[model samples]
Target chain A: MNLRTLLEEKKSSIVKKWVHVIFEQYPPDSTNFFLTQKDRFLNPVGHAISEGARDIFNALVDDSEPEKFYPLLNDIIKIKAVQDFSPSVAISFLFLLKKVIRVEAGAEIARRNLTPELEALESRIDQLILLSFDIYSKFRERIFEIKNDEFRRMTFRLLQRANLICEIEGEKTTPGEETVITNK
Target chain B: MAVQKPEELSKVVYTFPSTPWMDTPVEIKKGIFCWGNKEKSLKAVGFPNPRQWSVTDEDWKLPDNWKEIFIEGLRERVDKYRSFRLFLDICVRCGACADKCHFYIGGGDPKNMPVLRAELLRSIYRKYCTTSGKIMGKVAGARELTTSVIKELWYYAYQCTECRRCSLFCPYGIDTAEITILIRELVNLLGLNIEWIAGPVANCWKTGNHMGLLPHTIIDIVSEFKEAIYQVTGLKVDLSYNRKGAEILFVHPSGEYFDPNGNVTFMGYMMLFHEIGLDVTLSTYSSEGGNFGFFTSNEMAKRLHSKIYAEAKRLKVKWILGGECGHMWRVWHQYHNTWFGPVDYLEEPVSPITGTKFENAKSNKIVHITEFTADLIRHGKLNLDPKRNDKYVVTFHDSCNTSRAMGLFEEPRYIIKNVCNNFYEMPPQTIRENTFCCGSGSGLNASENMELRLRGALPRGNAVRHVRDKFGVNTLANICQIDRATLQTLVDYWAKGVAVRGVHELVGNALVMKGEKERTTDLRGDPLPGKEGE
Candidate 1:
């Protein structure tokens, strides 16, 4: 069989392996918990990872364009963005798919003289990795934006109180010039 | 290590940690922890060891005898509160609550597990306060109380929002939120407090509210609300400050008068009160209904919350009417009588308009706004136009304190159903007593800890995402002030178009007042549902 037929035949096992390896990045205890828990609300992170993985795999095999993967990639990347993972380590889970595809269907491709087709699939995975990089940056930027917005809202009352109450009589300090205690 | 067989390529190795949990060192990650209490804030509250320190520092600059103080404080608490000591001793660790924490479910941090978070303190309790622990040591799951242990305790203690979700599923009825409370009490002895809780505690103690608004500042903010109210309803709403002998004293979280979302809720209260002609007066001194001190220690909670009863006595109101806040009602319903009780100075809260006695609050003499509003709606007192709220396909998020502690399940919903045509409940497991936190309750709602907040917000946000995807829910309603602030940020991130609103904001939009001008917009100045073109 050619690469497409091989991939379609091996789709379930490949996605399963991809999700399992992705969960392995968590702590051993967490990995076990993720594997065992099936409730969506009870184990949201696990659900997100598993569901996002299958949808992303199907999207890839269907030869969908990169933009079609935004929601799927965003679901998993959003979780990893807030998690205690470095940026490279956070998005690195995408790279593991190539290794899984090679391992799951590599021998079949070789025997069928579909090495060029396998390379094309691997390049698609690379494109997904690049797309995840853009998603990671968007989420990280969204987090910072959230922090800024929360600060503005929290201080909304205080700022309004300051503006409507009175002018500074003595030191005349600006609103942003409070003695902020910073710790290195 | 080449794979000889193709099946070996998918071989997954599951290696358990060699070190026991007791021996595993704690690493305090950045973006997950809060900033330490500033010296000025600690000094304002007369707390011990008022020195500037950072969680990232090598030396936390604790009092030289911080260990002695922590041990002494823990022992004093164990002696003082029987329930606390029982909670410390009775946990069987069935792991029933292991998967119940929102943080654990969202972030996958094992330490965020309710059992493990409590064990951070329980292990120390075993080492210092128990005999078997002294003899068996790590075999009995005990560890020495070192600086690293203190750091870990601080890290995980703040990670818990004290929502008590885990306690709901505990077979042994182990209240992990109490454990987190006790841990925070001990850490305060060492000056290991986060700035978010400490700053508010100091402000509440000194300026009568968390935001440190002076009496005039509060009045000015209310005046601005008055202008907004006049512009919307075309009639002036009467407001009084500390007016003696008023029939009721209205105490709300100061955020209600200040924040944008809270301002809408505040306008809702004004419209309701004006419609009924209720004799209610606001107090600038007891402006804050939320007790941040409750998150710190019992003593500080008492100190800050004393202002409510004190203001009531000063004003000589018949009874007090509380506004839409989550933890404030928890403190009122659960701890008010114990902290400052016999409440003989005020009378029972009887609805002046509907003549319905709030028999549930007979002892405390403080009535929740929903309980009061629901009673009015039951009596068919206020003319409500639910169609005005058609712009919002709303859902109610049960604030943790109100749902678990106060059992206030139906009052807010009753009010919501009366005031809105469309409302939806989240998943069965994620509403009412089993509700998830906005992930920023108990004063963890600070800007610096955004990642921790977002991580903890996932379960609640995910449920919201489901409802929004399924039912076109555009508005999230609740009775909590912190929810008003944090869940807005949360929905902005998770459910992009979903807006966070207070339950009362919907009420204000739906209430049809007598002699009101031709209304064109809701309390938020958004165009009304049917009046959008005009």
Candidate 2:
């Protein structure tokens, strides 16, 4: 069978596998609920993961335009970006996509004359994976910036009780500057 | 292992150390706080102690008399609001409210505990205001008003969603919400207002809306909404604006006019009004039913809330109908009469369509849109087909204010159940008076406070997650505009597939308008269940 036709045929199963692989990072209890629930509305996390995975797979199959993937990738990655995944593990679904595709493609590809097409498809996936890191990094950066603001807010009470609201008034101060109250 | 989900956050993994909360200094943590207010936004509204400042600065540049101003402010508030004095003096360290605070429940932070949060301010109140605090000092549970104390108040006050769930459980009925509002008021006096809230308050004071949408901008947006209705349904929907002598003048949170889902809900309002041919006018002057000042101070709340009745009187409307909002109703129900009351010019609000006398709001002379719509549905006035909303298995999230402050329990749910075929309730504890705050409420919805918001949202998120696991419920219908903006982010982080929607948005989708084209999609432009699968 042609590579494109194989990819098209196995897309649903591939998206499912990719979602399961991504969800494995969560606790088993959570994963059970995230995976077992089928109702789209009730199993929102699972449904979203499926929908997001399906969109990414469809974009990958199109191959006509790769930019279509980012918007879809962004919607999912943003959730990941705010979620508790490490930088590498969070966007690592991009890597898992390759495995799902290869596993579904099967070893029969070696006998076929689809080597060039397979290599080209794999390389496109590689490039998209590289771009996915940028989205992951940017979102992580935003979360960091947000955390720094919160951290500073902790010491805000100390600053006020110490009579610090007006002495620094004339001086230009940058926003979200981390100042810990060391005063006893 | 990564804590990808709230359930994965082990109970043993403590949010705050077991060390004595009072003895230890508050260590700043990530994912639990945000930078303080901008100086510009504070100065715009003529807030006290206004000066250019940043939350990151080591120095806040306080006036020498800043301490005196705060004390006087406290004394004045104590005299003015009896609740303020009683909340401060009546607490006996009973732990009834400790576990009830959503912040403490979700974050596991001791300070998030309503008792501890009140203590942060109460210590100072005891210090300067009481004689024992002056004499015994630390021994009497009183601490001097130090920069650290002020900073601690800022940290803990914002952490509180001020939903008053804690107060409901308090033995002495010490309302931490009222206390928190006062702390924020005192904080605002020091120009420590967060930009997210201050900016909106400034805009609303000038332009009559939180988002700073001017009169012309509102007109253009409403006109565009009309155009979109025409384009989609092949029917004209012309909403009136600032029209004097109209039977009813409608006001909703400005967030509804701008946010995507909110706009869809507003469209639902338009469709309902248009279908019924109700003589309702949308007022550009009283465009916002929300009062951000309620989050800051009673005076600010009074200033902002004044626009409603003033505009109603100016426009000469018989009565007013308020749209779906949480805190707006809080202000309307509890504070409006106390603040800018005796709206005697406006007659008692009775729905012209269903002829339902809203006895609950007849005294206030303003009716909640949910009350109006639910009444309409009760009278069989609306041509609703529940099949239109078959795409959604929905659940209702009673916004904290509407739940606790107004007790608007069944009104919105009545509309949702009648409009949608499938409706599921979360744990009984999580709905009605016991409902959890969206966490981003009371001006904590700023992006800078994302982590605090996520952790604080955990209780509600976990509850919704439960229903999502049990039932096929994908949509969370709420009445608050803050929920419209913040709950979306909350759901995105905690539960991905679930979407946040206003109750009326569902009502509009189910509403079969006269002479409309065959409906293909809901108000949000999502395809109908039968229309799909083509």
TM-score of 2: 0.74
Q: For all the predictions, what are the DockQ values?
A: 0.31, 0.04
lDDT tens digits by residue: candidate 2, B196-237: 788889889889999887788888778867876776678999
**Interface RMSD, model 1, angstroms:** 7.8
Q: What are the models' TM-scores? A: 0.93, 0.74
Query: What TM-score, to 2 decimals, does candidate 1 have?
Result: 0.93
Who wins the TM-score comparison? 1
Query: Could you tell me the TM-score of chain A in candidate 2?
Result: 0.73
Chain A vs. true chain A, TM-score per model, equals: 0.86, 0.73
Tens digits of per-residue lDDT, candidate 1, A1-184, equal: 6677788899999999988888887766678788779888878888888998988888888889877899889999998998877676688787888889988988888889999988888888888898899999999899888777777666655654544434345433232234332232
